[model samples]
Target: MSVAAAWARCDERVVARQTLITFVGLRDPYAHDPHEDGRHKGPILTLLDERSFDRVILLGRPHRADHSERTRQALKELHPKLSVQVIGLELADATHHPEILAKLRVVLARIRRDGPDDEWSVSLISGTPEMHACWVLLAVAGELGAKLLNFRRTVHNGIAGPRFVRELGWGEPLASLRPETLALLSTRRDRWDDVDQQGAAHTPPRHYFSRAILELAVNLSRHLAPLLVKGEPGTQKHLFASLVHQFSNRASGPLLIFNCATVPADLFETVLLGEEGDGGDGKLRQADGGTLVLIKAQELPAPLLARLLKAVDDGHYFRARGRTPVKVNVRLILTTERDFEEEVRLGHLPVEIWRRLRTALITLPPLRERPGDVLRLAKDELERLNRTLPRPKRFSPAALAKLESHRWPSNVSELRRVIEHAVLTAEEPAIQPEDLDFELAVNLANVFTAAVPRLREGFSMMDYLRAMKLELVRGALRKTGGNQSKAARLLGLTPQAVSQILRQTEARE
Candidate 1:
């Protein structure tokens, strides 16, 4: 019989007996919350309850069985007729074991033969890649005319969908899913798009130099395809890091970020590399198969840097004092304010490590060169801060003009702080010039002056404009210390525009 016809036959059998659902997981702490009430139960238990499945088989590593058993017991109590099975596999035996698949097939086959008198189905709940492999096995049984029920985690309402199944990719399987399944997936995707749109909409105003910094970020992200950015204080390196993460191939992966500066230097290595005991594998291991963003990497000790560099080069980490080295395929994106190239040149950084990262350099521009961005940033920040504060507020035209005219030595971060401060301190709906931190305003006014005329005769206005633009660009480039996106935002231009301008300038030169 055809796969669809077979699935239809199996569906009739499934509705007759108590349906069985299986959960596959690798000991995650987040999954350990007690499910005594079963109201706010774990994903597996929740899926079973929602589908009204008669049985649930919880499978996980032996180390995690203690926690899994608690959940299993909760499921039994919640649905008195529901049967619960708990299976534990050795950590080493998980990925390569054929028995796991065999046991899973046996469970599904049994459920197919003895249909529950009431409505029932079986589902496998798994978030880990290894556990996800079970889908292939289930799909095979499904092909053999055994009824298969699949449940995917939903970001909203946390409910499972009941749908008839066929071959995994024989046709467009996702398209054939129940309306509820499609709706949940659509909602999750829309939520992601909304975040991206919100971030893009908040793009700050650009000054002359901002474009250059953005260019640097775009170039580094494109050429290197993946990179680690390190720069000095007030350089907006983190902003560039965010841009890179947003634009890279692994953008879909969780953007796990940790600042080395905020974390004590003594614990920096442990935090970045991760620890062994207490289910903590450190940052490098946890971020395995995803992107591990280390902000303020300059603060890390030389030894920790060496370990990280080794992991980056080898694509796996040799945990300190741990057993076997865990193989982790991860993209390392480190950001720092320190001039690592200089450090490498001065022999502070090893030559091998420098060689691996030489091509991925991205410097961020400081705030001073991108004066135009100041007003825009102020506006955006004020708008955001207004949402939190008691009343709506706006920067007066004169205040905005004053902001644009003054140099921002502290860059975007400083600008954000100033706006937040002004919002907090302002008495009225309008932010007057006096409301702004006068000290910052005075400091900025003294820093920037009108462009001095070039002594070289026959300098065209176009040439002057070009020169001025380049100067601002270069300054912003230096200020971001060389993150391109922040520079672009600082310049009120797109990262792509900044890169094009730079390329054109380079060609002309």
Candidate 2:
């Protein structure tokens, strides 16, 4: 489905009994409020009497079975022949968000199994805020093609009546949800408040260069055929893709991510290009009118890369069994840790896809390159950990110095873990250098093992040792920012000894 066609879908109202599936929320047993009486009574009466629904499914906490039964009996009094299904959740408290979402999933799964053909509608009037949020998420995800039925008492009649909101069906994304609901579900509530009628994009990272890269990505993400993002594994490749998706015109559409490294080649092809008897839509169709993030994109086999290239160029592709090509309006954000030039040279990446990726190529510098951001990100992570831990702790001068000086091979991900561990184990008030749990010795050992292999297999052991020493000296110099004294200190040797070793190594080279 094309993006424009999906957005142009008109609101629908289902009236028939067999086609109608109503999920009504049961009233809280303890609540005794007059103004909120429309919570249960209004939506039920409207659906049963006005809409003529075939079945009204009542959902509530397991401990409140009596409340659900009482509501069912009362509804029966109004329409005795009306089918009522009362379902009690195992949860004692439905107020928590995770619990509500988990229970809702079970309810949704059962509905799909029992009545696959029924058109469903949900009442958000009576459940807890968590329940309402969960229902909204399900609807927004298009996992449930359920219409949201709303009811509020009119001032003129002073009685609740059927109010048609909007229907959530296949192809509809989260942007179709009511603005208020979007605001409530969004974690960046502060940013949400600043947005205009058309929801605004997320703010980019704090770094100046990152912000510039994000600006470029946002522009390219909207209209480009296929954008390529190049970075190391922990260099925020996926994070940048999300930012690009959020800031683009397709922000309203779904952002489906698939890691080429994780998915098997055959299964991935099935997910990307649906087969004739697949019985369901492929991820390409599922991500229509949105963005698709392909992680480790360089790992894609040659044939699959060609297929994706064709899809991007033509804006359509044939499904497994379907003869006719299905038009798709999805933005592609391909991320890879491998070098694009090297891949092209090795024929790992097809020429056509490589050309398509030329539309936009974003390279994210490693965290070590952005040295200024380290302390800021570390402190921010510390603040985040403080909220969950027993006590807040600040980094000591020595600890902070070590953090700044260390060569973070895994980039931001490694730094985050280090900070999390330090926050958890450090004493109150201040985190000392010892609080930071690092395995430098283990890393050195691994480096040595990797640098010298087959030493016992007729290779010269002294030559291997000399080569390792030379590499270590060069690495130390690079890490210490060309400071000989600092490099010597890092290698646990005197500056004069380091100078002599360097001179000897240079002469040998």
Which candidate gets the maximum lDDT versus the true structure? 2
Compute the lDDT of residue 300 as modeled in candidate 2: 79
Clash pairs (backbone) in predicted model 2? 274-320, 275-320, 276-321
The best candidate by TM-score is 2
Off by over 4 Å in 2: 1-209, 440-509
Give the RMSD in angstroms, all C-alphas superposed, for model 2: 21.4
Residue-level lDDT tens digits of model 1 in 1-509: 89999999998876654545455443221244455653334455545545665555565566777667776766766677877767664445554425556655665556546543534343433433333344434443353233444432212112222222221231243434433222222222211112222122221122222544544544454432247675545566655665554444555555566777678777776666666666478877776655667776767777777777677677677665677777876666788767787888897887776777766766665667555566666765675455444578998887787778766665665576466546655667888877677464334333343455766767687877777567656654654547776556445456777787788799998
Off by over 4 Å in 1: 1-226, 262-266, 275-279, 438-509
Per-prediction TM-score: 0.45, 0.49
- Model 2 lDDT vs. the true structure? 0.64
